[model samples]
Target chain A: MKILVCISNVPDTTTKIVIGADDKNINTAGIQWIINPWDELALTRALELKDAGKISEVVVANVGTAITEATLRKSLATGADRAIRVNTEPADAWTVASNLSEVVKNEPFDIILCGIESSDHNGSSVGGLLAGMLDLNFISSVSGLDIENEKLTVQREIDGEKEILETQGPVLLVIQKGIAIVPRIPSMRGIMQARTKPLQIVEATSSESMTETVQVTLPPEKGKCKMIDAENAGEVIRLLREEAKVL
Target chain B: MNILIYTETREGSFKKQGFELISYAKALSGMTGGEVISLAIGEIFDEELKKAADYGASRIIALEADQLPDNRNLSKLLIQWIKQANAQVILFADNNTGKAIAPFVAAGLKAGIATGITGLPEKTDPFIVTRKIYSGKALAKIQVKSHYKILLLAANTFGIKNDPVVPVIERHNIEAEYFESPNKIISTEKQTGKILLGEAEIVVSAGRGMKSPDNWGSIEELAQILGAATACSRPVSDEGWRPHGEHVGQTGKVINPNIYFAFGISGAIQHVAGISGSKVIVAVNKDHEAPIFNVADYGIVGDVNQVLPKMIEAARKIKTE
Candidate 1:
């Protein structure tokens, strides 16, 4: 079986997000970018499946500016067999999903995996949008996934319990945090091999769509940090009611 | 004026959080002197619609359609809904589903969006809504200057209260377009835990100091006994000891429960951002200078391995009493 992992280039979680002076874009100055954390899970799981000889090739796909090539290369270093870069300025989730869907139409993979949400925007809309656009069976927040004989078993976290699901292959799986293995670093040999690996860059099939960002402002300031001096649990309750008004 | 609320359901049953969305919509409706109308798509739940009245909904709308299973199509359907009802504002349950579709609905309606909102809109010239930004590190007062407004509220942000009067169900037809791409309905699987983090009243999260993945068993046991959910710090997940889904950090899931207990966590800024909304935060760590103590309602500076067992025993005793 062949697997495709959709990745996103986003700011690191530790970055201090700031709106630019124009208030229409994120301030990219001094901020480090990484492959989105959730996407790491997808890449990691793909590597694990490859190690188990479950699949032949792991294709890493991303939609973003040319700078995103670095992100695709990083995924290649981690474990992806090949990389596909759809060169475009990443706009809204819809635009990205449309580009991915168009590229995916040319290639028919048995399973498609992606992160549930991106770190920079926190939109959490792309996977669902792509599934809707492609008209494929899709599941979000999948914590566990196992594939055998073209049949896939997935575990999703619901409100109060987990629900086990079964579906056929060629389905889209939007990975949540707990679903997959942690990423592994590339060895010296592997890193050298990645240099020779196929890293194809293609222009986005979709046309440029206009998405207007009105403004981005900082959140309001919080009140002075309130501390509760408590000797016991009962005192905690008192502070909650009297001081915090939270209980 | 009309106010619309998006309700969530699972396995033909309505989630309790859906009612909280109703309460929030009702509050907004009261401010506008409008009636609160709900839109419940997906699996059917007849009895759950009856509970919306007590929470402040004047009318309940049920779209008993299987085609509207996912949020993408659901948001498209709601577009015609807002036009039909002429809804001023739409309220959504701020879970995975709600968050997925809200931005789409906002974009479609050309409305401003505010997510992770904790409360209703404060009456100012341009309506101001309060939400947590920077992962609960700060509160953001957003002034949405749009003809139609869309708000997705955080889960557990509102406390559920029982109302004396039952709400009236006014069935309304939803304008829906079928998903032509033959998306099949497959099976869903459950996670390995006694209680879900969103629904749990209490939560006990551990950090890197637990040392090994094997040590999680004790945390799970205590959580099982207390009917609590188990959570972890980002490093624990980064170190491969726990799943990333169990992580609580700035980029991870934010949980707000009645009681949140932390063990072996150093309370880094990113980790603390996720739990700042918890009602009562309790910290247990060996470091007296840990930042978690700054926000914890109760702090116990000691070795968590030695303290957790005894605390669990004491908690069990209290419960039996």
Candidate 2:
């Protein structure tokens, strides 16, 4: 079965967040962007499945303006069979999901893979939202997915148990960690080939965004870590009880 | 206006997050002048279903189902009652189950939503909610323009309260095959009786300073003493000193415990991304300049083997006093 892995381009995880002048977004100056770490893992897993002959094709898709093409090219270089970019600035998870729905429905892919949450917005909703819009089965927090002997099984982390789930086709799995050990790097040969790979751009249907950011602010500045003498560990406990009150 | 909260029960009992939603629901109700009506869809018990009343639910709607449908089907089912109540606002716990269903429900209702909301709505004039975003380093104040709104409260953020109210319980029956799906549960590996790291209010995590996997007993003992969960850094898990499930970092599980005790860990930015949501962080490391100390609210300059036993004994003695 063909797989469509939905990826998000997000600021690097270590980027120090500085709110922009508009108070609604981050300062884009000198911000490094990459395929979101989790989605990178998803693309890695899909390519692995394709390599194993269990999957027919691996297509990577993202919803963002042209700025997202670099991340999509990185996906192609890492061995996605094709790349699709939905042209628009995603306002919210619903808008991203709606645009991705158009791309998924246009393809014959049976499975869609999404990162559990993007490190940037961290909404953890786009996968399920798209599943609802497309009337496909939804599973979240999936740590493992395999297609063995033409049957699909998924490992989902529930409250305290790991549920092994078996399903037919046409499912969207919100991938958590453990799907791929280490994300694949683009080989020199693959990078050269990626230039000629199809980078399809689709106009966004521009569904109404369900939410909008009013303002973004950093947390209140706090005091530095209070150091205590090693010999006076007991006093630290007292401070926890009386001062921090977290004990 | 009415607020509809989707609550869940496990083994016929409510988990801490269940009441947390109640706490959030109560706070949301107070802010918006909305009554808190809870909806639970599962094998709810007669006595267990009434627990929400103690937490100030005005009325409880229980949908008893032997076999719960998948998240998408459950969304369709919930859309029924969500509209029936004409709820202006909806609240859900931002966990595995809630994340799976809440988004679909929002789509069904065409409601504006904010998941993993760390606190109550900042404003109702334009329907704004504040949530942790971008690796917990920033807060995004989101404005939901839709007439209906959905908010999923994060675990351990909203404090559950004891507000007594005699709630009316309305029971409904749902069939096992309510929706068509082709998914089956194969097996469940249950980590019974152990505190899960995700929901853990207190977490005791260690790094390579322990030196080997053999020293892990102390970490588990310390976690047991504090009724906390045990976690490790990515390197420890990568080295197979601990299971991947116990690893917390940018790649592994991200945790937001109330108290996070880091023993011997020189905090990497990836590790900080995971625990950055924590309210209070305590670090015990020999290196005074370790990056872990930068984020830690409290720190001790000491070796893990020596400081760990002392902290355990002190905590044991202090708890009794």
Per-model C-alpha lDDT, please? 0.73, 0.86
How do the predictions measure up, each by TM-score? 0.77, 0.96
Which pairs clash in the backbone of model 2?
none
Q: Write the per-residue lDDT of candidate 2 for residues B7-119, one digit (tens) a residue.
A: 87776666668888887788778888968899988887888888898888998999987667777788988888888988889888887778788888877888877987888
lDDT per residue as tens, model 2, A50-130: 999999989999999999998998999999988999999999999999899888778757889999889888888898888
CA lDDT of B140 in candidate 1?
50
Across A6-91, the per-residue lDDT of candidate 1 in tens digits comes to: 99998777776677777656678987889887888888888888888777889989998888887888788887899998888865
Off by over 4 Å in 2: none
Candidate 2, residue A143: how far the Cα is off, in Å: 1.3
lDDT of 1: 0.73
